[model samples]
Target: MITTFPIVALFILLGLAIPVGLVMALVGMAGLHSIGGWDMVSGIVQSTPLSTAGSYELLTLPMFLLMAEFVLISGVADDLFRAGAAWTGRVRGGLGMATALAGAGFGAICGTSTAAAATLSATTLPAMIKQGYRPDVAAGVVAISGTLSMLIPPSVALIIYGLIAEVNIGKLLVAGIVPAMIVTFTIIATIYVLVLRDPSVAPAGPAVPWAEKFRLLKVTGPVLLLFAFVTGTIYSGIATPTEASALGALAGFGLALSSGKLNLGTFRKALVRATYGTCMIMLIILGATIFGYYFALTQITQDLIIWVQGLGISPWIVMVMIVAFYLVLGCFMDQTAILILTVPVIVPLVVALGFDPIWFGVVMIVTAEVGLLTPPVGLNCFVVSRYSGIPLSEVFKGVLPHILAHLLALALIVGIPEITLWLPSHMN
Candidate 1:
């Protein structure tokens, strides 16, 4: 009853339209009071926020967010899309493929999925639609492509998962590289197949001259260098993740300035936006910590682990069930809320079952990527739809095919753990 009450209340509060962080804190305090009175609640309420927000690792969040905001204001997404289209535009559904390619590149620097989706929708959707691409097909491709932001390095989602799961943040970031590449290509392939089956959905464009293609490629150099600088320092052990994020933010500022985009007004705007984003994430972390304390007091995770062990079931079966649970959960919850709420409970059970936490983190993230596209609360889909002024139904229709690509990517990562681990293992 103790365990069930908090979980049940959480859903009810969320369904009632309460903010996620407040709901978590309320349920947690109520549950703690039920178990250990106000003294326990008092002590936790005072400490959890400080401890959760005080970590040096937490600094990485704002820095990376600021970096993304600066990059967004710099107009790099347009450059990336133009370069991508120059190379891929001649092929059937080439513009769609180009959006995916550009999305992955932007994701490497941007990190947050919604921002990436909004930026791409604003920059690429009009171009695709202008080029005679089907609106639904173009919108769908933009929404799913934005999900790559959360899978690539500097990912805000991965950083939060690492902090909560007690895994190495650096390793978690590096681990995403290969799986992200696989998913990127999978999305591109899906676009090609869809265009092939129904050519009207995406018409091919005039081929670019080899000289113009090479010229356009130069626009990609600054983004590539920024990615290389950020990831290279982290992988080479030359800087901590926090240090890398700070440097990346500085590089982004420089990029914006060089492009004549940065001014006092734009700089202040980025700071304010990054500050707002950081505070929201920190509040969620604070609430999750308080809730985690109450959850730990209930001893549910330990009991669940023991119970599962005694079931005599194959571990893979258990793994599939957990993944399925996330898929359902993703349909309703935001990705950050899902991670902060569940990782505390799920990581221990996963470790007890002999799975690698790093591998599971990647799988969990890929699953979250799927959630970003699924209906009801598909955050990325909503962002794309709002930014592109497309109807929500068309955006949903567009993502149906890419959802299959996400599932295929998820299956490969789950079945072949090396796809996620090998690069991290090789990192210096």
Candidate 2:
């Protein structure tokens, strides 16, 4: 029944094209009836909102989201990306590479893939396109690079997964560091390769003087400081992730205000957008909780595990299969929705195989991050195309290399557990 519940719900969700949050609720409602009585369903409905909302840690979601909204609204991301581009534009494929690096830096505090996509596309894509970069390359770089927001610290997806899976949010946040860097650098390298092969795709911009580079560095310092505060405070045990997020949000707001960029209008818009985003996220969590409750009562997950173990297949094979499943599912579902829908089942299977919950969380996020660039429903790609006036087809073509780079990073994290584990362990 647990298995059938999700399968049936998947069809129901797609059939009606319902909002993800509602679909999760519907699935949960149906699964509950199959596993338990209406009383159980009632209990879930009553408990889930309070459970999801009561988390002090969740305070970070709105704070950090508001922070990013302010940055985008106030045009701070534009300044940072401009500074970065000015410094990096002299080299082969430099503008495109700068986009990825800037995205990473922005992701350090922003943590929202769509914000990164919209801001970076608005900030960098037009510049690169105007400067003679290939449309697909520009669009693809923005699309895939925006996904850095998911892999970096303070990622909303990671935080949500950690909360639901009962993993330590700090550990999940720490674990994301190496994987994020690996993906970011690999993307830059991919850009270099592409430009090197077809020089026409990226004509190098004129170099900025060292003094000007220093000037650009001055503009970028605040973002760097905010990034350090968010991650450093958490790793140093000086503050919880929630506290760090609050700090980051305040810092982002101050930075924008200090720059004379954020005003009454931007503040209002940021709050409204943050509230809407927070509501969407909370609703999804509530829905997943109900759905997961029903799935648990059915014991289908347990039965499937036993049946799979009966096959005498190694646990590693099962692990690989699950990762493969996420990659495929990513082609359709958004990362947050996928996490809410799958982690209840997947995390348990991963734990059964002796994988660290934190490590698996990182792996899950990275897999889902790839979905941000996957075709058809790839949100980041569409966002970039929208902002850059590039054809979606071109953005799809451009994202191919970055997609391969992400796949490689995913394989490494899967094969070597230490990469994700080292930081969290050392900090402890």
Best by TM-score: 1
Q: TM-score of every model? A: 0.99, 0.96
Q: Which ten residues in a row have the lowest lDDT in candidate 1?
A: 224-233
Q: Which stretches of candidate 1 lie over 4 Å from their true place?
A: none
lDDT, model 1, position 200: 95
CA RMSD of all predictions: 0.9, 1.6
* lDDT tens digits by residue: candidate 2, 1-428: 35665667666776576877788787778777666668877887887888878988788788888887766755667777778788789987899888988899889878889989998888888889889988888888889889989889879989899878988888789889998988988889889889878999988999898988888788677877888778888898898888988888888888778878677888888899999999988888777777777677777679777777788888888889999998999897777778887888878877877889998998888888888888778989888888878888999999998899789889999999999999999874
lDDT of 1: 0.93
lDDT of 1 by residue, 205-266 (tens): 89999999999999998898889768888988888899999999999998899999899999
**Candidate 1: pairs in clash:** none
Candidate 2 TM-score versus the reference: 0.96
